[model samples]
Target chain A: MKLSEDEIRRITLTAINEMGDDATPELVKKAVSRAVSKLDTQPDFSKSTSSNQGRLILTSFGLNQTGVVAKITTELSECGCDLQDISQKLMDDFYTLIVIVDISGSSKNMSEIQEKMNKIAEALKIKIYLQHEEIFRQMHRI
Target chain B: MPFEFEEILETIKMTEIEHFDIRTVTMGISLRDCVDRNIEVTKQKMYDKILKYGSNHVKYAQEVEKRYGISIANKRISITPLSIPLDAFKWEDFVEVAKTLDKAAAEIGIDYLAGYSALVQKGFTNGELELLKSIPYTLSETKRICSSVNVASTKAGINIDAINLVAEAIKKTAEMTKDQDSIGCAKFVCFANAVEDNPFVAGAFHGISEPEVVLNVGISGPGVVLDAIKAAGSCDMNHLADVIKRTVFKITRAGELLGRKVAEQHGIPFGIVDVSLAPTPAEGDSIGDILMAMGLADIGGPGTTAALALLNDSVKKAGLMASTNVGGMSGAFIPVSEDQGMIRAVENGSLCIEKLEAMTCVCSVGLDMIAVPGDTTAATIAGVIADEAAIGIINDKTTAVRIIPAYGKKVGDSVDYGGLLGKAPIMSVRNINCSTFMGRGGRFPAPTRSLTN
Candidate 1:
């Protein structure tokens, strides 16, 4: 969590923007010092808490159509799954969607969620795959 | 935060478009404790041990697949070579043991069960000879049993007598299963320096040195490597090697992670990860395709062996870096019938048995899945095995021969064994007679290199 000189400058500029006309050199310096100290004391919360929740990735592939995301997310929400991230792209009339969800909060088990997802995929005429997040991490990271 | 969208997309693309997968998750179960003086009792003990240790193997592998969105193509089991425990029994008893293995494999829902094997690198024991004699009948009678015989090693030289016997047994197996394109030969392999922890089939068997039960994973991705090379566009040899090494590192890491998870789930030790570029008959998944991507006009051409050496070395280096324990035949596999690109090369006359032999000198395995004419002599088959064994012994690397004598078939005829075994066109062998050389049945002494002590 070390802040570079560039990052400190950016923080100082942001503090100035917040202070407006009241921004003086001494006041800005004080704000910058406080900010640096606060960052030093706080551990990287995102990194530390990343594995606290169960993570799942859902991918779908099929013909391009409307409301595919809406239909899928609605089903996910109904299962008490929280959508954490999503990316979708369409090329040559073919649609591909990759959705990451935090399933720790989900009321349903993995198999039950899979069964529901499979039915939705069948109804939509798309091939949907659900896998845990660790797979992607293991494959992509060293 | 460093995991980019592009990387995720690449993994997905490899799986969806390139047929990337964990080829096999094999559970190696040692059956040394199942020995008994009574043949039937020994057979019963083997069945019970395999059932007890491997009943949940397939289910656990499936769970890992579902969790990771990765496909595990096969769940298999390998036991200690059967000869050790059944040595006191008759040849008929070995067949009964093969039947028991096949029954347990079917009952436990595994595709193949390996370990119907004998080790006679130097010389054969009575029990080893009995097991070797039972190979044809056992393989023809059973559906899921695979067998291997280690006939040579660097430390013990070549067992010429054992090679001759195995060659004859292979011919007999083909004759017995000629109705099905001699499919039984596909289940047998003769090794020069066989390893105990190989997770790939037709040769995989739990060695006596291994623990009671362990999980070994074989990862295959010729498609992924090809994609990475294509993405690199054009580069120097060093840069190309770097690209392959980096790509293989990622692939092996993924396999190691999955293997550890599966082993943990099964409460067993995680054995080695075999990072071989094992190809299927699927289009775009061929090792030959990888060579073609490397600017080769055709496989088995002038530069094929050099390209293979580079690919194999890069794979091993990257795999070693990615995992603490990397063993088995961790190199590029060039099985003729199993790889579609190789099949095309053979059919087009660009590749031949001679060039394939030369390639095996540098690649992982030896003359594998090759189909010869029905009229091939057992002496000629022995010559082939001896040649491959000499290369392995001199180089001190594991080599195997899994050739099929296609019965009632000659050159210009192709036999289709379907699925992973694929189709192999009958390739002509050298016409020079080696009966005089093979007639002198004796041990080929260990090489000068064996005097390291």
Candidate 2:
């Protein structure tokens, strides 16, 4: 828990007034700790969901193969992942697919999803990379 | 698509093909409070403190890597300089501390743990002198421990006496570990104006003023920059610099994000991102390749220093724009052994010690990972270090010497330490005796540049 400057100043002033010229370093420390303990509210992180922690950017490429999207989407759906957007391109026999997924509602974590995707990639003879969308936002955006 | 198709592909290509990766995510843990009067107690306190803060360092970093899909090459730790805290102990006790640190680092699952260092740029304390005496043994006995000593700085001038001591320590470390191509010397560095929060190992130390613990990152992507410069095809110098800045800006952003994410996982304050273009032994990851791509015929050519200056400046400009906390040696690194192109240049007689020294005037480090004949005298090595320190003091930039006086190996012979230490071809050095000058060593007074304050 971190106290703001104003809160710390208030606490220090209050402690000094209460000590009334009798405060030593030890007593001041004790008073500050007691005052701080009075406001012991845990920092709530779960309520702040503004970050891109739950979003993932999935990129895949390989030789053009049928049912690749169906196979991938089925796996994601089974894992409770929501596919928000996708863009793909095909030239000659090679195809590349980029996907945006919101994994906040998914039961599995990033590692588990990556493990399942690795098996799918090996079976389909393609390469699939699932990375947090924050990385893209960091590099491509400001 | 919120992100352009080309941007997506560019990021992917940088990672999958161009060998883009975070070089190191070093956790700086201050061991200031762990010192005790008893050697055994001090050792125990140090071990427990390191484990308390560093047990999950590698695991958290791996989790971030999995989430971001960006590879982190090395997860390391740097602590308060050993000689500072253990200044009251004897040289033998310092060796015990080194072993304890090595053990703790191994248990923490890190490959390297730095901060076995001393800062004697002005003069040495009794304990600092003792620590220097213990370095050869500490380096020889410990596997994961890395040591460094600062013998010169801009404000305090050059400590030629300390340099001679460090030179002797280097020679002894080389001879002690001679069975492995004098590999122990690779783990030691002699610095002038060493930075406190540098995340790169063999040179990093948690400065005295740093917080209790912080995470610092070193970003590396020579291949990405090289490819970008090549793609700018036939452009003039200004256009080339613009191209390099844009590329570096994006990488620096990504590097900072990765660093902050890892720091968040560890619940530690995030430190600066070292925007140095450190090279690895792998092909296409060479800083020399980037220099050549900037139109240098080779690494040690005539215009090489100017090209490096441009690259280093652009790197700093982009890094400063990309992240608010850009520190460390944020420039281009030109270590010979770790860079494949530099190795090729040295092998072909293109890059030499003198040229590398001149290039260091513009870059971050000086004479890094250079190999010389086994018969090179301690005074000659001191001459080399003194020269490098003179450049660093005069310019007020961080410079270091990680030269390996490869034991029993002469010029035309190469020392192969494998892995990231890479392979260094022994370059010939002039045999002019500088001992009388070194023997008269008191202190090289501060340069005129030190009077800015």
Candidate 3:
């Protein structure tokens, strides 16, 4: 966290007040550093962590066809999405695919990625869903 | 993989096939500051305030839905109960204010906007009386404004005079909107022990204690629970409850997460997640079916109340454990028109109003979406509301009456409103005369439950 000039001035004044009669550059530096470190260590439990993260789970399913995985992975690679995990299964002649990707590196945001996937789904006559991974963790884990 | 394969598939199945979804995300906007000496100015302020706070409600909710891959069924708005802020307005001005609310709702593209309400659980103020007198005209005139009045509570007891006046209002609303099968009555709710943070509409209001604006959510997934209970097979009640709890716990967690995300998008405070098993009219999404899966032959069966009680308890327990902000009416909702199985039971002669009343004693709401003969007297309607209120005040729970007297309709005829309103088969109400008792109305004294402190 970067402190603005006003915040730094306020912190300096507070540190000087604490250092009182022993006012010295070294002691003031120590006090200010301690306060900044303390501010960095305490967690803000009120802020929702999921909204800031860019990891998501992608699920796609459709009839068995060639190049289905290739088409999807090709799009993700082009968008700079880092695929962390991939799982696939062929059940009753239908292909079910699940992939976990970190999209913070991608050029596209969640809505943009979903819009692209929707187009691919429509072209291939398949169904695709891209959801933030926080939902899965919240529902399935403690 | 960080998640088990089955876990991912389970959530997809719940949303894609099991009819699991967030029932509503309601933004509560306070209109208290919109009061003015000029009626037109009051209406304009109310309209402007609603738009300022709620214009982006639907858009923000849709973004969250896409982000989470779960659908939000309805995006609605609730405001400070109109009667409170506009207490000095006459009956005609009240109707004008309601029309302004209806316009605001339509402009924001919401299906319903709640909080046209008053709380006269003990006695009425002059403003409340005028508001009550305006309800019929308001309901008949407005297309999207939903109204509710709390005429009883555990601490304040039942206001028999208010109940009587509300009954007459219901009759007038029904007759005035009879062209649409008394659909106006569907937009009104009369409550005993009405909750402040309820997200469900026709009964939701931004209470006086609430902040300037907040976001509250109501979750629905009776289909998911029904499927879980069926998979449990022929087990003891203990194992059966375990199945229900496990299912509800996951759903409640998801519900809270969705609610928080929606509130975050709005840059507002996240309120409570009402863990209600609200059902839709679609097949397989019926609370009645869940009861049957819990070993009842049908809803309104001998063990129906027991089944509902167990289900309601499990919902509350799991919801409480899942979220610290669990509130509203956190239990099972068994509206007749909204649940296919309940509609089937009523149509098959297996369910009656009396049985439904007994069942409401164990559920979140009372006598929801039931239709009666067009000729049902106002005294009879008052009797029904009073009975529901008595149950609520005595038990210290929330119960409501949203009954419709479908005009020119009787015991075998049904009113069909497509979409979420669904359909209601007119059921026979007892013709027993209750005016003699209704005539002697003053106030039902607060019960012993009020002395808990």
Query: Which candidate tops DockQ?
Result: 2
Q: Model 3 over residues B15-126: C-alpha lDDT tens digits?
A: 9999999999999999988888998888888898888778888887887888889999999999898889988879999999999899999998987899999999999888
- Arrange candidates by DockQ, descending: 2, 3, 1
Candidate 3 versus the native: TM-score? 0.91
Error of 3 at A140 (Å): 0.6
What's the TM for model 1? Answer: 0.89
Report the lDDT of model 1 for residue B9.
73
Report, for every candidate in turn, its global Cα lDDT versus the true structure.
0.88, 0.91, 0.91
- Predicted candidate 1 versus true structure: per-residue lDDT over A20-120, tens digit per residue: 89988888888878777777775532222222248888888898788988999999999899898888878898988889888899878676788888998
Q: State the lDDT at B404 in candidate 3.
A: 98
Chain A TM-score of candidate 3 vs. true chain A: 0.64
Error at B404, model 3, angstroms: 0.3
True contacts kept of 2: 0.62
Task: Arrange candidates, best TM-score first.
Answer: 2, 3, 1
RMSD of each: 16.7, 4.6, 7.3
DockQ for each model: 0.19, 0.37, 0.30
**Two-chain complex of model 2, DockQ on C-alpha atoms against the true structure:** 0.37
Better of 1 and 2 by TM-score: 2
Clashing pairs in 1: none
lDDT of 1 at B43: 82
Q: Where in model 3 is the C-alpha error above 4 Å?
A: A1-53, B450-453
Q: Deviation in angstroms for B228 in model 2?
A: 0.6
